[model samples]
Target: MQRRRFKETSSLEERLDQEAMRLREHKLLPPGWLREQAFRKARQMNIAAHINEWLASPGLRAPI
Candidate 1:
C-alpha cells in the first residue's frame, strides 16, 4: 500500500485559524453540534501545533 504526500502552502497555525474563522462565519456554529465538533477539532489542532513547536525548540535539542 502507498500513501500520497503533498507540500502544504500554509503553516499549521494559519490553517487552524482559517478553519475557526470559517466556522465563526457560519450561523450554525453557535447552536449546531456538528459545527461545535469542528470548532473543537480546530482548537485541538492549535494545541498540537504549539506542542510540536515547543518540542522542536532549540532549547529542547540537546547535543546527543
Candidate 2:
C-alpha cells in the first residue's frame, strides 16, 4: 500500500469547510472565562457600575 498526495485548488465552500475543520481540531477555551464569571459575581453585589467607571476613567484621560 502507498500513500497518495494531491494538490488541488479550493472553492470558497471548500476553503470555509477547511477552516472550520482546522478550528474543530484545535482546543480553544472561551476568552476570559474566569474574568467573565468574576464579573457576573461582582454584578450580583451591585458593583458593576463602579467596575465600569473604574475601567473607563483611566482610558478616558487626555494624553499629556
> RMSDs, each prediction?
2.9, 17.1
Q: Candidate 2: where is the Cα deviation over 4 Å?
A: 1-8, 28-64
Question: Tens-digit lDDT track for model 1 on 1-64?
Answer: 8999999999876786777666555555457787677777767767876787788789998798
Top-lDDT candidate index:
1
Per-residue CA lDDT of model 2 for 9-56, tens digit only, reads 864445544554454433353656655654455444344444545667
The segments of candidate 1 whose C-alpha lies over 4 angstroms from its true place after superposition are 1-5, 23-30
> Which run of 10 residues does model 2 get worst, by summed lDDT?
20-29
Compared with the true structure, all predictions reach lDDT values of: 0.73, 0.53
Candidate with top TM-score is 1
Per-model TM-score, in order, reads 0.59, 0.29
Q: What lDDT is reached at residue 25 by model 1?
A: 55
How many residue pairs of model 1 clash at the backbone?
0
| Global local distance difference test of model 2 | 0.53
